[model samples]
Target: MTDAITPHPFAFPDAALEDLRDRLSRTRWPDRETVDDWSQGAPLARMQGLIDYWRDAYDWHAAEARLNALDPSTTRIDGLDIHFLHLRSPEPDAVPLVLTHGWPGSVFEFMQAAPLLADPRAHGGDPRDAFHVVIPSLPGFGLTEKPTETGWTPERTAHAWVELMRRLGYDRFVAQGGDWGYAITNELGGIGAPAVQAVHFNMFPVFETMEAVDAQEERALKRLRDFKENESGYQIEQTQSPQTIGYGLNDSPVGLAAWFYEKYEQWTDHGGDPESLLSRDEMLDNITLYWLTATATSSARIYWQSMANWQEREIEVPVGFTLFPRDIHETSERWVKERYPTLVHYNEAPKGGHFAAWEQPESFTEEVRASFRHTRQPL
Candidate 1:
């Protein structure tokens, strides 16, 4: 862990806002392309429409206010400033649940789920499902500043989360994650940290240790392999040359928008039209976070920091996995149990993708709640 203390509130600086407007006004937009589809890139017309809305219509302050309304806080743990949203349930004795966001995502990903998790009744769920929720921005993403030193791997991230729970006076909590969040939460349990009572994941990576290559995993693995072979160029690029790409992304707003928007369409379960599944405003809000924070480069640091280190370790916690149809590939229960000796639950979703929080919060919440039912302490 970096010897840095926790972070403070991330106020939207006026200077940053002024700079955004200036950039928008002076944007040297690309020439009108003749094509209609996104083959070449963001369709020229759609890009223009979004840019106009972003520059003229969207309210950054309103978004900031919504963020502020969530009861966020910052505290230093193990030398890093950690910014997190802390929503305590009205249920008085709610279970603590730590939710983490993955790369290309920020705490904002939980905008809808935070309140819902904190007060399930408000969302038409049982009060038993209400939870004391903690959603933190990974160090160096969004409001959390990037680590200036080393040892910021996923394992270290788990440590930070443990310390965070400790500071809040919680002895045990349920843990949930997707994408990189899944990796860190797994580490929390794998390390046998008493702070984490159980773990739940929407996105999980399966290795060979799980049951003998079952038919489903064999097929999922084949598809995974194919997906990587054909479309994993971004990982290679991010790991090796993030700064190079960051330069181009940082120089042009549209470049940054296109870079992320492409992934939203390709990696998500949006059928054909992305808007069918996700709101355009939502997509832009996320992209705007990256664009304004200039987090494109720092966010990639996670890839370079942990991608290699994690393949060397295994998570030993009692794990539960819920596979979504739109995910890159599905993991067979046999495979997961093989890799994770303590595996306890396996689930499947009708529809959703890597962005499960945004796409299916109800199912995601219930799955998390169900996975953690075994972890409750005896009164």
Candidate 2:
């Protein structure tokens, strides 16, 4: 692959946008679930409301403008074109930091948090907490070129991140993530890359074999069981045959929206409605990204490539973690320290969930700044 990095300003053709609206208008929705609640999936009324707004009122160009403002760029890495948003801080001492987004999310996840982290002074915080943020769209996700061959696991993605940072002139940097981002960031710390000074996670992967030591651990275990039994249908399908499901998601705009919107509804720290925390436009901005790029299948392939052999490795690099209360899983400090021996920071956020950065940008920004504070001394 070439080492050249070039600007990747993007705008969907008017025809594509019109096609998306036509698809939404022609969607043949399934019958409503018998249950009033979301036990089955996204409620029919909710899906209808989301699609109606998306088709009639949502502004794709506005979202596109916001994304363009983040300095999007692309470079060929590991036989694929990787897309990333590099936001440099005004502070000369700002630390270089890479932030990875997980499945069902894109670089849009960090839109609000990136600016706050990059220029803390402008966000009513100390200038010393500034970061030159880098947000990369994972292989086969977002604008990144979809891989034709297999083996693009989180471990491989972690190494590609080091190369991406190197090309950006950052020999050493910190990293942070949630969901698959956690897996990738964890690999970054474990790969023995001296350039990866530290890592942080909003989601902690707890092994199924670990025994609960206390009330908190017990509750966490229960939640894990619930997730595996009930909330993992999508995981199982995506891991087993992503292509089979991809045909539907890629064909129907409403299908793609419902698939992602269910996660936002179930994962965010909202009451009964996801819009309580995330605006309709905000959620659509991410879901729309998947639709426009036609990455639903390519993104799911990450699960097919990695989930079967997933295992945690001990990370010696200094580590930090912020477990949001409403997240799918929460691990105790004891469990985290066992894997991250040099654990430097740990906090239990009062609110937020799996999509912490997207749902609670201010809190996510503060947590990131605090997590890497100790690692900022001359890299």
Candidate 3:
């Protein structure tokens, strides 16, 4: 039997785009937050600014053309249709790398970086650094189908990625990710799948046990505490009651925009405004993907499914991490080594944040290239 994967082009109809604008134009009003600062949540004025642009100025057709240019396709794995962008490099010896995106992130995050990784020579990098990049939208996230029932955890996703790569005729390859993609990649290596030769992550997981608290570690620890105290309300709501919030997010375009824009503000390296780092178009492109796909509830279910799998596992394969300065939960080298014993490469990027690949595609490509350069020659 053949591994018959289907080619599914990303084509959203004109009516859908019109409907999105209609919803944005008719957004219900919310009173201004009592405090001037963004203490409570997304400020009404800020969301209104975003909505104004989304309703009037944002161009979905241009974004759709870019997405379609990637030549996206789909394959059925474990009874669910998976959406991915597979770009083959000109270099014969190019490494096969599967890149994964997490929540509030779609394949759009890697759109700029994928071609850079695949054809580094064209982008003013060494020909030896080329990679055959495959970027998959997580099961419930983008063009992929949402699970009808439960059990779509990170472990399951890891297995699906392994199979997906194998179906693409890759016997052995490398993996890289951030956010939920981090957990899935770690789990992939931890499962001891011979197909996964080495893995890398921009967002590293920190085990609960602490070793020492140096100045850097102290700052990271404080940030972790701050996240749990102040920034975890969305996490709790999504993990606990995704369906409740999903209703509002599904019904209202502004509600969905506010929900994600808040993270883009807090998580990115930019000033208070997320628009400073990512253009209104870049952000809306992703937000609109979620809107058209109707994945608000489905995407949140991953948190609930993988809540228990948050702890570190013994990943036997070699691993690399490029820690961006502004990312949340900045684990120290020592902390990371404790969990990833076979850590072979680690670098601290001067710029970017949680969405490194999306924010700084060049920096992200350089780090990814460096990480796997040594691991390229067959295992």
The reply for model 3, stretches above 4 Å from the true place, is: none
Order of quality (lDDT): 2, 3, 1
**Candidate 3: tens digits of C-alpha lDDT, residues 227-247:** 888888888988888899899
Model 3 error, position 53 (Å): 0.8
- Candidate structures ordered by TM-score, highest first: 2, 3, 1
Candidates 1 and 2: which is better by lDDT? 2
What is the per-residue lDDT of model 1 for residues 203-242, given as tens digits with 9 covering 90 to 100?
Answer: 7675544443567767777767766776567778887777
lDDT of 2 at 181: 97
Candidate 2 clashing pairs? none
Top of the candidates by TM-score:
2
TM-score of 1: 0.90
Weakest lDDT window of 10 consecutive positions for candidate 1: 1-10
lDDT of each: 0.77, 0.91, 0.87
Q: What residue runs in model 2 are displaced by over 4 Å at the alpha carbon?
A: none
TM-score of each: 0.90, 0.98, 0.97
Give the runs in model 1 whose Cα sits over 4 Å from its true position: 1-10, 30-41, 207-215, 312-316
